[model samples]
Target: MEDKNIFDMLENTDDELMEDFTGLCPEIDDEKFEKLFAKSEEDYKTRKAEIKRAEERYNTEGDNSVRGVERIRRPEWLRPVMMAASFVLIAGVVIGSTAMLRKDKWMTGAGTSVPEAETEDTTEEISETTEEPETAAATEEEKTVIDGSEVENITISTRWRDTVDEKIRAADDLVTMQQGFISMDYNDFIEFAADPSLDWNGPLPSDMRESEKDKIYYIRVKDEAAESIADLRTKMKDSYTDNYLDNLKDFYNNNRYYTDWAGSGFDDLNEGDMTDKTYIFLEYRGKLYVNSYVKSCAVSSGLGDSPLIIANETDTSFTAFLPHVTPNVFDYNDVSSDEPMVEIDDMYCEEVKFVLDPECNDWRIDSRIPHDSGVFGELYNRAAEE
Candidate 1:
């Protein structure tokens, strides 16, 4: 028989031969089998053509590697045998894929076959074993009883109340001091004609006339207030980090009309009520003018009862909530009036937070969440609008 007749012979196999092959394969309709066989034969032909080309090329350009060894060409029968094997493999794959697709079962590539029944049983067993313990543990935990000693371990210590009070006092003191500057005003245009320290040769502005040498008036911070300023320094050093202290110093030195106050000798500058000598005002062109110094008549606010509530706490750090209320402006110059100049109903109605972090030996105010500017902000804003 011709070499090309091999495929035809397989297709027209006798009833006995087909019966033997049928036992090993899944049953398929004749039409589907014929179509699959035709595709396999076409692929085999294309592969055979490629092999023939490669053999012809090898023959034309003899290989140098086989110089000493005998060159062995492929046998003629081997081609048909390989083609038949390829056809059988293709048909087997198609049949196997179809069967697997119909059943719709998963397979692993590792080639370790597990029985379907055994795999299902193992999966169910694993799920059951994992779920049962978790349910039992949850039920037992729900039934657990915590006694007094255990409760005490979880509760905040009573000593923390004192700490909270101390924090509130410190915060109150600092905020009050900051608001003290709101009522203070300094007139930069005031020319000190009487002062020997100022050597003035420049012409005065059209709107300003220099004060008579003897007509200068003095306005000063009170003695008690000066002592409080000294005390503020001590409190700040104790309650703030060096970085925060520097920031506070810079703010006071530049903005609060207290240029020399950042230095260690600030207490010496204000000793024995010397605030009068430091602050001098003059009537310039009929306008009341104060020199470099500021005169404070403050608008202040204080925290409510139970000022601080512990928001969160740990060994090294804690956060507290501050409720501010009853904001009022107190003008010392307004002695004729009994009541405050302005009593803001809800100046600091919003809650603010203060954080304490561990300093060298004690906890110090680290930072405030939204910097609480206090009653000064309200007064300043009102003054600006007016």
Candidate 2:
């Protein structure tokens, strides 16, 4: 019986041996087959243990099959769902990674995509808004008339009227003589003319030798005053007279002789044509004289009294008075026929000096002498002789 079973087991194929052993063998009966096929508790435990052992062996040797043959079994019904879930999870992970890469690319390109042209325009606009406005230079459009000529070509000196105007404008103030008058003393005028700082082009009234040239200075002042004589008188009344007198005295005492009485009167004169008051006049001898001659008011009312002095040169006293002559009171052409005068022997004097007697009340001698002396020694001598 042992020999027959051995021969039969040896002769049977794999499937056939499994089938015959299951069907006919009494020792390996239906109960045993059922236990193997239907998973009894012990069978189940054994199967689990075998699966565990197989997994351990597979982990260790990289093989999980009987006799090195692969086992084939039908998958469970839920296997497809699990596979689909796994596929979905893998696809989600790949999609999320791709989205992150795209975001990084966008962030990296931000700086390179900015428009340089817009930035430049913005900078230029800001710069232009912060810049200063351009100022127009002085030109012919700003030229003023003087001596019948449009004074376009101006050479500024410290004594020049235009230069004084410029300086006063720069300082935001009005241009009054340091002595507060239209003119200064002969020496003061000379010093002022000689100073490179003073803007001067021609000779001053006191320096003019030719009567015609001398008349220009007077005419200039008269014209200037005519334009704004009312305003000038107002200014004189307000503060110019006091300021001018003090400044004139100081300038005269410091730079020139104290005998320069003409400087004192120059700033004190009022040039109007409607009042019969004392008039301050400039002498050709560069001396200041107060004329008692009456004249019309050339300016407006309420424009306080002109700065006229009532004292002669010998008195050394000063008394304030009102307008006594017109704006152009002493016409340059007027000269007396019989007038006593003195001749100066000193060439260094540049002009002659006339000392009238204390009783002589003629102020024209003073006016004519200083006025002509400024221009020519001959005219100065003639006036001095008169």
Candidate 3:
């Protein structure tokens, strides 16, 4: 039994791994397993291509740290193993990011104004302001952090694989859940976002995930009892994954954008939002819990979403101020992000929009509108007295 023989057996298109793997993974239906495998393989190939392109660009372009990690390409015999590894990674990203999320695309925007929530303690919020000293320079850092005492607990959901597997075993209960999400109003969507118990849908096809979130992803349709931006922010914090701040910082500082503010006005800049932003930030709150990972410097590009722009028709958009991230500041001479902390212009937070859809339909994002805008568009100077 040569090693290649085993690989060849695995690759025997018609009679190969499927029967054995399915025999092993009997939990999933053959159709579903095949679909998932095919989808995962496509994604794997795409990622591999992306990695290759990045490596090529790295060699051809200026050297940078963003391209530091390289996926070890195993011998062809290990293709199946490699595929499984990629699936696990992507699954983690999908499930862990969105508690009950639509897709991995997330947006955080902030500039000035926009704050309200029925759950919000306006009196308390106002009272909290007195503790801070306001300055002319403070105009850009307009966020107020919830005291640790005030925070209940960050709701991190169960692992994606287990949660998904459980859903599959539950006689496709997830499908019903998915259909029910479509009819949610802005407030309902917020509730869904804030809830840590829900997983967007089980064994959901990535295509379904992508299409559903955008199309059915409507928000702010009704003003009555609408969720305030403050309420949204507080709720969103419920399940933020580790290192979210760093991922956000990387997206803000490094994503390719027109940045009319910068002299680097979209010269060879990657267009779209989600890919440019390093962390798609599965909306556990906005939609799912938080999992933050460093973007591919966003220089190499993948996913992005600018929270600066808002949708008011089927949704509402708001800007965010990251008063807690850093002091409001910028260097006119160094708009180009040659260094991490150096290029950071302001203490920014993410902005979000709530989408409304028919509760009976499967949940979806509104793809017609921009899902990508160099991920998390800059808020400009938002810091100020709140």
Candidate 4:
């Protein structure tokens, strides 16, 4: 055969180049190359026959045919793998040396890298304050807090509370005699409710003058209240997330109480301990326990439509005075719990108090207790005619 350029031969169509291809692969040696081809042919025939036999067996025996021949079942990847191995074997022999296909850039003149110096621009270290950066990564938006900014108050001490204890006990005893509304004796409740202190102050207020805004005193906050509300909200969220209690979750979800008080004006101040200036203009609900400031007694709750009242004391704290009641029960010289009592339209009415906290920025409900006997009856009766 006449010598031919290998590059020209490679440029020809594969079919033409492959025709008598063994004639070009002399490095593989004729004997070894022929042996490989024969082996490949034998493998192809064996695989084809096995598949034919399996198909016939399946036709005859259905699903059970697979059990008849495990050895003859060809692995799926075997053909591709064998083809690849045969290709590599032929290429290795034809190429004469593996280095023709091997990459040894580290050991070769062809693999040398350009030896340029790494130049850094030393003009200045651009300060963030002076220059813009190439990439401005987007920051995650901050989540808006669910807050109403409320400060709760709970009255823990008052001189009149002690003076009212005997009335509460006597009223409770009288109610126990009455049918249906029998509260456990004040004695029985002594385990939970401690008796008021003996440090006697003045009597509970009496007369209609206390309820009238013209006669009573009040204080207002223009800016500190808003700041206190913000503090309260942050604290509440921190507390809620820390505990993650379900009831706290409910409290966290409800924004009504704070919303209700947002525009509500100054609170009435009565005669009491007015020692601390910070305690003035403290913040929520009626002086009594078990009340909702957001909704009327009977509006959302299927109960009495009792209106709210606020009674403040000059010495320290306040109470809610019934608007309709002419006499202030607290003012009377010898006021019984029953004298202040009034039956409301509903049986389930309650009262809540937001007494001044030590910080005096917000009011909080540390805890609440329902008025007993005469007091309870008065609150009930005092619910508005609605």
TM-score of 3: 0.16
Candidate number that wins on lDDT, 1 or 2: 1
What's the distance in Å from true for residue 315, model 1?
A: 2.0
- If scored against the real structure, what TM-score would every candidate get? 0.27, 0.14, 0.16, 0.16
Write the residue-wise lDDT of candidate 3 on 116-171 in tens digits. 65115443443344222232224323332232211111111122223222222221
Q: What is the C-alpha RMSD of each candidate to the true structure, in Å?
A: 48.5, 63.7, 28.2, 48.0
lDDT of 4 by residue, 244-277 (tens): 2223323212311111212212234333322112
By descending TM-score, how would the candidates be arranged? 1, 4, 3, 2
State the lDDT of candidate 1 residue by residue for 1-386, as single tens digits.
68878757677554457667788678789999999999999999987786566444433322221132233467999999978976776566556545553343344333457688966865565445434455456455423122211111121123455654565455434433343422233222322224444322222211223442222222232223233344445556565655555565443333232222323222333212222222222222323323332222232222322223343356666544332222211111122223222223222322222344444556666543321234323322222222
What candidate 3 gets wrong by more than 4 Å, as runs, is 2-19, 24-347, 350-386
Tens digits of per-residue lDDT for model 2 on 93-114? Answer: 5565456545544755634554
Lowest lDDT 10-mer window, candidate 2?
344-353
Candidate 4 Cα lDDT to native? 0.29
Give candidate 4 misplaced runs (Cα > 4 Å). 1-305, 320-351, 358-360, 371-374, 379-386
